[model samples]
Target: MKITSAQAWWVQIPIEADKQHVSDFGRLRTFDSAILRLETDDGLVGWGEGKNAAGSAGDYGTLVHLLNTEFGQRLIGRDPADVTYIWEDFYNGVRAGKARKAGHVMPDLARRGLTVAAISAIDIALWDILGKADGKPVWRLLGGAKSDRLRAYASGGWADKDNIGAQLQSYVDTGGFNGVKMRVGAMDGTPHRSAERVIAARNALGPDVELMVDAHGTYTVSDAKRFAYLVRDCDLAWFEEPVTGDDKIGMAEVRAASHMPISAGESEATRFDFRDLIVGRCVDILQPDPACCGGITEAMRIGTLASSFNLRLAPHLWAGAPCFFAGLHVCAASPASFMVEFSLGANPMIHNLSNDPVTVVDGMVAIPQTPGIGLDMNEAVIEKFAKKG
Candidate 1:
């Protein structure tokens, strides 16, 4: 079937919490997610999501325009079944400027921002169309699942919260999460203060629970090293994006000096970007987000590359329902994938936007069994949160 049309919606769902949030990415506030919908000539429709942080962090408007105009123009007459070819062509159209004329070339990293994010949403929807058409789950289509369920870590332990210690304790006590990740780095005021927060979380969770820290690329090499050394006794599960994501050398240096397993790649958008990070020995764990890393098509490539290097993949999850399922399928099929990120906090989009939020039971999330990500989009939520013209 050929693609008929594509549309993007900007939805801002406010967040409610018992306490304040100062995540490494920023303070926890509203959930601003960009949703893409693609329809084929044969009447099959698919949903996808692009990551846009709360309070206009990402170029949401540009992403929406690209998908609805340029991206839609490119895919209208194309076969939906040729997922890989479509992905390559779309990448070329965005990055290479090939859509403008024949043999047009551009810089390698030219198309490396919200444009790629838009492409990711489109590519995922295309895969969903294929899975639904073939009557199989995306995981099965991606060479079958290695396990029925994947272990998940309770994500988002914001440092700004008043009861950071209690919040972490509650994750294990009530949410049944065996592992939990808390924010670290710049936003926590100072290195000593950040260390204090980490120590408090470790003390509260005890030794049994696996603890991870996400810096969200808020530190320099020296600062990251200092924080790492300060919390050396904490036995962190991994240090995520300790420094700027693009600084492979800094990442390697921090990894070496800290003597800890560093995790990155959520900010990386393509396999080419991943290659340098991998060969540079920047991290022990790779956290590619399917929503932004060229969807499942490129995420699988990133996963395979990580496996070859003996590096583990624990996908960084933060998008909406569609992107969440995309990450789940990739994790389900990848044996190297150890843990998936799950937000325990209140996200109206994730919880209210779908009938199924891929429930986590005892720190393990079951791979979606139904065809094509196995969850129906909640139109009601979309209508309620959709931005007006």
Candidate 2:
């Protein structure tokens, strides 16, 4: 079928917390998301979510306007099934400055957050359409190598530090998740107390269960080295974002100085950014958020590149709705991906948005067998919490 139209819907979803909490790494704030919907003349519809962080809503708003008003017109008579070709045309066309003069700014972190997010949603929808077109699942279309059951890690351990052990134990006991990651560096730059916390967790969980620590890019090189040295005997799976994402040199320094594997790149966007990381050998694990990192198309390319370098792909997921499903699909298709992240906090928007909410059984998540990301949006819930512009 030929292309017809593309539209963007910006919706606000509130977080349960009142004020934005400051973690040791990055600022935490809540806001609405900008969703993209693409439709073909034959009635195939695709969906995407843009990177809508705290103050980046306007960036996505502009991207949505450009896609709907400008790019949509250009792709009107083209075939929607040409996923790769269409992506190349759109991406290269923008680089060629065809859409740049049409009031669209060059993609930045804020712009890319929205651009990539929207692109990821559309890319996923396109893949879904491809699957339907071929009468198969998206994983099979991408050469399904593993089973549908994805090993899951119990995330969202941001409760009071005192309650962390109980919270982690509760998820392991109730959710049946054997692997768990805890949020470290809670506003304090020191690594001494945080290392103690890690030791305590190791003692509590014993040796078999996998435990990870996310510094959230909050520490300095020296601090990361200190923490890594203290917990070197604890057997952490990986140390995530030990320093800020921008500190490549610092990250490399941490990698050299510490025995633990360094993981990062969640704050990065596009393949160009990742190319630098890969070429520099800055990290051992690459965590690209499909929602933030130029969608599925780019993420697949990034995964391939990471595979070539023998790096692990574990996507960073912190948003609601489309973010989770999109990440899931990429993880399913990527051979190098080790695991998928799930937030354990009480998030009504995420729970109500998906027609098929994800289930984690025995520390693993079963991929949806349905069509088109294997999940449908809850329109009624969308309307109920829809943010007014």
User: Highest lDDT: which candidate?
Assistant: 1
Model 2: runs farther than 4 Å from truth? 16-31, 52-75, 94-114
Q: lDDT per residue, candidate 1, 97-154, as tens digits?
A: 4643565434345677776787789878988888898989999998999888888999
User: TM-scores of the models, in the given order?
Assistant: 0.93, 0.86
> Against the true structure, whose TM-score is highest?
1
Candidate 1 residue spans exceeding 4 A from truth: 17-20, 24-26, 52-56, 94-109, 159-162
Inter-residue clash pairs, candidate 2: 48-121, 120-295
lDDT of candidate 1 vs native? Answer: 0.81
For model 2 the TM-score comes to: 0.86
The digit string of per-residue lDDT tens for model 2 on 223-341 reads: 88988998889999889988887888888888888888888878887787888888877898888876668777778888888899989898886655666776777788898898888
